[model samples]
Target chain A: MNFSDIEILFVEDSMDDATLTIRALKKGGLANKLHHVKDGAEALDFLYCKGVYTGRSINDHLKVILLDLKMPKVSGMEVLEKVKSDPLFKSIPVVILTSSKEDPDIKRCYELGANSYIVKPVDSDNFFQAIKDLSFYWMISNQPPHHL
Target chain B: MKRILENFIPFLFVMLSAFLIAVFFLVLSNIKTLDETKNLVEETYTIINLNEDVLIDVISIESSIRGFLLVDSDSFLKPYENSIKNIESKLLLLKMVTEDRDTDGKADELQRLIILRIADTKNSIINHKQNNLTIEQKIKITLEGKKLSDKIKNVIQEINSRQLALLAQRKHDNIDSDTNLKLIVGVLILVILFLILVGFAILKIQQQKNKLTDELKKSNNLFSTLFEHNPACISLVRISDHKIIKVNNSFVDLLGYSSADEIIGKSENDLNLIVETSDVEAIAKLIQENQIVKNYEMQVRTKNGTLIWTSASIIMMEVENIPCVVSVSMDINAIKKSEEKLLAVNRELEAFSYSVSHDLRAPLRAIGGYATILIEDYKDVIDADGNGFLKSMLQSSKTMGNLIDDLLAFSRLGRSEMVVSEIDMNSLVKTVVFEQLKNDAEKIDIQILNLPSAIGQPTLIKQVWVNLISNAVKYSQHKPNQKIEISSFQKNGQTVYFIKDNGVGFDMQYYNKLFGVFQRLHSKEEFEGTGIGLAIVQKVISRHNGTVWAESKINEGSTFYFSLPKIKIKTK
Candidate 1:
């Protein structure tokens, strides 16, 4: 839940994709204090200090949130809107992870202040490389705002 | 007009007069001749002396003689003298009826002699002074009387013979009269028979004539009735030039013609009512084929020169044993205009779908590209939490890019031409799977089962095998012994290929939508896909006249089956 403490907050619904992503991040040397959650709702709870993440601070600066667009409860689009609308957490970059490249969704995500979008590859090696590239580019290179 | 009046005949009166005159003449002649001939024959058969006429005279005297014979009681003898005188007078009359030629002239002499003799016999009887004469005296007296009578009788016979000979001679000489009479009688009989036969024959002929006249009247009534009250426009068309021979009231009303006579004896071209240039040709063709056009549509010009669209069909028939066409027309113009309007609508829909696709995707590529750059170029300035957020944003943009790409691919598949050729599928599947496997540093065993070489579009069909086999390899990567088997067999004239893997499979319920463009059963964090792979597989198979399906269970592996028809597959 603490973004300053964690380098990667991987909000995903699948364990295998999460494992591969983490492995790619480590291989790319971008895996520092990587934290993972199962869904958008839990990611929101962790971010806004609600429910299980209530003990956490309200505005903890984070470098990147690798968000899967499709998730249970709150979706990535909803999470993106909440974060981008809040000045307290607006500077934290959110990257959309998805399988489809449907145009309307991409337009909507970008309009909602998503920093970037990435499609998961079907090729195992390319998928692994995509994770590596996503982690290295977003976590190791991207900048974030100071604490609120 | 002049000939029409001339053609009419009053045959009934002429026939009746001829018949009655002949009958009257025949009846008049036969009556006069039959009467004269019957009377003449009766008189020629009369007899003489002992004849019925003579006997009648004798009986008259008998009454007086009976009174005279009873004279002894009174004066009966006085009446006997009178009776003898009466009998002598009758004998004289009989003697006068002589057949001999000499006696005919001496009739008086003979009569005197017969009377004297009769008196002598009477005197002798009276002198004997008896009511009955003695037999010898009676015999001697009757003999004397008979002897004298015989002499007179011979003379009378000669006279009778002469008269008979004369009558027969006259009869022989009257042959000319007989012939003339027979001629008159035969003529009379023949005329009567002829008159009777004529009367009977004339009656039958009159009856037959009446029936024929009635039929003619009925036919004329029917013809005139149809000309006045028909639903269809009727026209008499002359065969030589197709001129209107005569037009009915219906034709005049329907065509807006002034009068039947005005339209009569004029060609169709003179009316100028036909719309199509080929109207005459169509009619000619119809005639050649002997076809009856029931409700055909064509244009026509009204009498006022207004163009009228009508469905006109024709029937060819005989009128007074002459060929002509009858046309029935109905209006139909609105439907043709609506059909033209609908054709325009379909073109608009096609243009709209394409324009929407083009305008939408241009901006997507830009948004996706810039996002990736920001995350890549400025990652170091970001904190861990900030970095995580940027990374997710970058992933989202790439996902968007994949979404766009998958959508485009799906649409492109719809119209892509599939050129089928002989495909070495064993090599094709091997190469595709091997390329995927080569990326992984770990060596995995993929046992390729029986593979086939078949005809298909190599590029598209290769995509099918590649997607299926690569997916198999990807899912089973974590297994202790990662293995995938590829095999093919023929069934019902089709080649069905199977790809089996020991990997994490899906539930059957989710499999239904698995081959749709963006229908994904697994989460993004597990199996990475745009969900268009199976869709491409399905499309390529269909292009080759094929089908794709799968069988799976959670925790167990899956087997993908794709079948392709072995026909000459034109992948278009």
Candidate 2:
């Protein structure tokens, strides 16, 4: 679990949803160098190098963070707020992957500097395809900052 | 009050001047009468003095004549002639003074006697001068002369007495006139004093009346200014006829009229001011019941025929003893339009949230992702019961996904814009029933009855028919005969379409929950449904300004009725 090697951070509270998302990413051949956290608090801890992540390098930034809106403890909105406010990790791209395309949530995510917002589709085939395309776009098509 | 005084003051002045004029004429007449009396007294005194002078002249003539007889000389005759000449002139003066009819006869008799006496004396003197008569003859002539003198003295006495009587009468008349003048002058002074007092009182009353009038004018001006310049639209209408009695500037401007005269005598109906006559009736009823209507909303058609909404506050008032309704209206058209827009936006937002929740089925179904992976990865290791449990989990998740989709569709029906057109209900129902029963294995019998055409969005109405017909077919699938009937008829100017199914119906007491979103009367095992079909049907029909209702009895068939207004067809 070297923090420096982690390029994609997935923050989701539902283990099943996380498994599906990771499987989709793995199917797209983008699961290597990916890290998954149970909720927003673990995501923040890992990003800021706190608690169990204290021995990790603080300068290590993920290429992109897939943030879910609703979670236990610290919500994705709070995580985005902390990460976007900090000059050290503000350049890291955040993609809001949530079960809703609600206007207010999407609007607020963008206002908090979310790079992308996508609503999860109800159909399993569409959901899998959406996740695969998003992973490919962020990991392969899009260029990451040199610090990542 | 001041106006009354203003009229009274001039009248009072005129009356006082007339009184003064009357008094002035009375005093002038009295002074003229006194002057006439004074002149008459002076004339009477002159007449008496002239009478005395004539008597003295006669006496002197007699003495001169006697002296001429005694001396028989020319000097005595000279004195006699002088005396005679003086006597003649004195006699003429007396005659002139006594020319009035009452004294003229007396003065003439005195003149005759004096002439006879002078003549007798002259004859005697002539006899003495000739020395032709005895002394007895002279004595007799003298006696005759004396006798004539006595007659003359009597005549003079009578004329003097007449003059004295006239003087007494004139003095009495003068005293009477003086008393009358004093009485008239006293009465005139009292009358003028009374008139002056009355004039002063009138002046005071006039001043008070003028003051009141000034105050009234000031208040009236203030009221008119407020009425004419107030920012809110205000009108006074006669209560009996609803006639506009007066309208302020704002009211005129609000109605897009140039002058109040255009609207003053017109009734609300005459001007077509109220868009809904029913609202007018309602307001009238309220006013009759309460004598006041406050914050009543209505649409007003302006002068240009543009309808605008307003909130009015009206109260009954008395104007010039006539009952009138004074109404103040505020332009609420902008607020009303914005409010409706806001409600529409809110509905859209609600629909968006439902659509967003529809997206939650993705993660919800993903919750079975682990089971899916288990069945795929450990197909041989898992027992049959374990595999069955995982499959049920997946099935439940899929069922939930279907429910979310149905819920989203229901919410979207609320937010979607409707494109209204003429729809052929007969073909629409037939197509829906055919599609719903295409793959059915049950011996279902659906009788499509005669259906009337309707005006609505074809797509939405088709969806409503599809839901209702499919529900009928699905519910009656357990029946051995499986009879479903679709029919439509006209009811209350609306085309009512109903779907009848011989299925396991619900109790009438739970009818309220039949169309509720996610409400289910049967368990999932008994009837496989998301419980959103009736809710969607209700929403779609309601969007067309129609209604949906159902009549059912437990263990009996159900009839779902939905109605759409039957618009009158126009003939070209």
Candidate 3:
């Protein structure tokens, strides 16, 4: 599969959550340039153009990254830390999409330079609307920095 | 050394008094001896003078008689008469003077011989005057007179020599006594000087000792006052035996003992006071390392067998040269109870929030999402009843989700740390009011008075305003002319803000359930709410060290009020 021209790197561990998010993005017509990774490790690999994503151009910067907090191997915090710390990718907007609506987690994500934090609502419609609105905001309404 | 110093002054006083008394007696005896020697010397001189006078008179008589006999004139006879009168008086004086020294009747013999000589001289004189005496007879008489004269001279010499000897011995005694008196006085002066020096030193030492004793007494009183009367329970335990050597009133009271005697002289183990022996060991270890241990929390059993929590500070010290631990314990049972209670509550809230946010929400989301997907994808294939069931399932999940969210918010209100500052209530209420009404602000008759500033966490206070304003707006929505009044008043040093709305207010019978979580007086069909709004308001207000209450009359109006402290609470 072609990895270039990817605007959104969606990282999530739960397949059900990932499917619903992708469906919401698809419904919004924002799924074409988006690439989904299962965990933080895979997301980092894709970002650094390593592992299965080797040979992907480094200059193809992501416009936004939707990161989940709780994951299997490498957590979303680690991914967010690495991406935000790297000067090359720090400019990319990272939105935290998690089911945990804890205050400390939200504060920590923001403190770690997250652009936005959204709780995956228990109600399907609200969650669907949240995803739809977030994707639309990042894709169209928000003006991305040059090189991001 | 201190003991010796304590006894030294009195001992020195007694010794000095004894020495002075002895010196007084010595001087008195010496004076008496000198007086006796003086009298003896005077008596010896008087006796010697009397003896010499007698001898001189005898010699004169002898010479006068011889002159008279040799001249044989009337002038010679007159001289002889005067000589005889002088001889009698002189002999009487010699006899009187030599009475004390009449050894072997020497005075008597001398007197008799002097009389005989005088008689012989008279006879010679009579014979010469009458011309009836020869020269041989006169010569005989003169010879006898010479003999008497010689004897008289010998006796006078003997008496004078004896008196002289007595005077010389008395003089020797006087000199000896004078030397003795001088030596005694010199020695006494030296001894007195030495004693004075010793007395001064002893006095100085006594003064210093008195000062030290006074200070010690004062400090001892101060220490006992601070220790015994201190609110903190204090106990001294011997390190070697772990026996409680001392306990204050507070300690006795803390342990529910009858008196300090009940606790003192008993080990903590003996009394079964400390609940955990390990805690004591741990405290001992810390004290050993630091020489003091502070705020070590432990549980102890009282005499009544009631266990209580105490925050103790143990200091390693010496009491009367015995190594001991001075444990000062504060009865922290009340604080500990509240702390434990708070911890338990927080843990439960956390678990509930976690379940709601992570565990409970996930499955709810999946159920709701799958149902929606089924309805979206299999709408035509499924029957209408199945579609209705799916929709109902989605609706139930949504309601449960709202409940979970409200629960999570309520729980998080407790766990969040509050950062307090001055909150501009006038603006804060207006913002919340504007947000709640949005474009529908013109529909309701909302009156906002001049609200006072309050001290609290701004965000939490804002939430309080949001919940109260939203409730007023929601409840007053049915009124034709909905009047919502927002204002604040000062009550008991707190700024109490209330929102009054003319709406279908609930009955006062359910006032107890007003701020209870998930406790609603109205049904879902009546008011679409999870009944968490007032609960959240109450929680937010309480966290700010304030209170919340409401008054309402059914079908008339309701006024929800919450108080905010004018001053911020100092939090640790």
Candidate 4:
């Protein structure tokens, strides 16, 4: 797979949550351009084009970055902070898709410049619907600044 | 010392008066002595004058005798006889002048000598008249008369000189007494001035004492009133002995004692008021550090041996120069009981919700997700019955997952801090209605009247509107013509907003269970619901310090009403 072709960088710690989300994105026919990282560290590695992701290109324009809050080694909050604070990556849209419907987490995610925050519903069908809608909105419906 | 001075002032006045009286008596006696000296000096002068007159009368008698002898005339004899009578009268007057004390008998001797001279004059006069005298005999008689007259003159001279000396001495004594009286008077004046100043000082001191006594009395009254009537139980414990020196009425009542006498002079340990020895030691340590222990909650035993919670504050102070600790305690039994119960319930709810949200939901999601995936990916491998079982598993998981989410949201309502502000009810309701009935706009007829602004937490109030509006739409879906009426009114200082709907309402008898968690009036087949929508509505409205109730009839309609305080309606 070409690293520059990746549009969605999905970061989540739970394998089950990741599989369900990826499968929903795949069902929406957007998985070919999407990439999944098991934890926040791998997401940063992919974004910075470091470690095993050294072949990845930093110049690639991404459609949306999906993040989860609790992860090993690093957190999605830190990943979001890094991406939003950097001038090169600041215009990229970030979405928080996590099981935590906690008010503080949602508030903090927005405060850290998350474009959208969605709680992953416990019902599979509803979760699938939420993932499909967000992917479609972020990838196709919402206009990227690069096109603008 | 002041008391002693107060007592001594009167005695000092008495002594001062006695001294003044004695000085007055001394002055009186000195004045008497001066008067007597003046009388003595006057008497001496008078005696001298009378003695001189006696001398002059004797001379007159001698002269008259000589004249008779020389002139041999009867006129001369008449003068001589007059001289003789005058001489006798003058002698009697001189004697009376010296009557009080005949110092040297000089007055009487002078009188006797004057009489002798007069008799001598008479003899001479007789001889002259008879013409029986020779020249030699006449000379001899004259000489004897001369001698006798000289002796009389000497006696008068001696008496006069002595009287003159006595007058001088008495004059000197008078001067001495005048000076002595002046000195005594000067000393008396000084003493009087000193006494006056002392009296003034004493009076000023007395006035200050009276003022201080009044102030002390007032302060004492204030202290006793505050100490006895203060609501907090207060006691003064001596530092050295740890004995309760004083306890107020509140303390007596708090300790279940009939009188203060039962508690006073008793230590906290003796009364068993300190339930834990560690608390006493901790307070002791705090006091040693001079720290003011404030609102330290502890358990203490009362007189009846019942333990009660109290928030006590202790401070070290001095009362009447004795080091003591003043402990003020408030009975917090009711607050403590409620606090404990609340904390326990909160802790259990938090733990339960946390596990439900973090633990139960993920596995339930996995079960449902896996079942769906199996049905989708391997439709042929799963037979009809197997697909049915998988479908049930998926359905049950979804239901359980929903139950957990609703439960978490309900518990979060209790745990979350609410930030209340002015809510624009009209705009808020319009938004919720649009969102809830956006797709059903063609079928549902909804009328919205103007709603007054209210004071509430915005998010929670939004949740209330969401739950009620959704419930209204859900229940009335079967009706061919659906209607929802949203309006507001002012009543009893509250802004009451209600949602009326024509729906398949439940019986009023089930109204008790209407707002309870997971309580569904209709079967799942008839109206699909998790039964948390109305409960959430009730919870949210109640959290806003408002009331929520519905009027309903079976197969007719239901109207849900909630009120909010109108105090902050004008708040921006």
Using lDDT as the measure, the top candidate is 4
Candidate 1 vs. true structure, TM-score: 0.35
Comparing candidate 1 with candidate 4, which one achieves the higher lDDT?
Answer: 4
lDDT of each: 0.67, 0.80, 0.83, 0.85
Off by over 4 Å in 4: A1-9, A28-37, A40-65, A72-74, A78-94, A100-103, A113-118, A123-148, B1-223, B227-355, B384-392, B424-427, B439-452, B480-491, B567-572
Candidate with the larger TM-score of 1 and 4 = 4
**Over the stretch B263-370, how does candidate 1's per-residue lDDT look in tens digits?**
887787888877687976887688668757766667777799867556667777787788877665555546645655765764464344343443333344334334
For candidate 4, lDDT tens digit of each residue in B240-261? 9999999999889988999999
The fnat of each candidate, in order, is: 0.00, 0.42, 0.73, 0.45
Q: What ranking of all candidate models by lDDT puts the best one first? A: 4, 3, 2, 1
Superposition error at B495 for model 4 (Å): 4.3
Lowest summed lDDT across 10 adjacent residues in model 2 chain B is found at B354-363
Which clashing pairs does model 2 show?
Answer: B1-B209, B2-B209, B2-B210, B5-B206
Top-scoring candidate (DockQ): 3
Each candidate's DockQ: 0.02, 0.21, 0.44, 0.32
A best-first ranking of the candidates according to their DockQ comes to: 3, 4, 2, 1
Off-target runs (Cα >4 Å) in candidate 2 are A120-123, A140-142, B1-11, B14-363, B371-395, B398-515, B519-572
Question: lDDT per residue, candidate 3, B1-572, as tens digits?
Answer: 75776677688778878988888898899888888777667766776776676677677778888877776656655655676677677667656656675345766776777777777777767777788457897788788889878987897677667677767877887787789888888988898798788778778887998899999999999998998899999888998998999888988998888888787788988999878879978986897799889999999999999999999998988889998889889999999989999999888878667755776777787888889889998999999999999999999988988887788888788887888788788888888888889988989999999998888889888888888888888888888999999888888988888889998999998899899999998898888899898888888888878888899999899998888778655699
Steric clash pairs (candidate 4): none
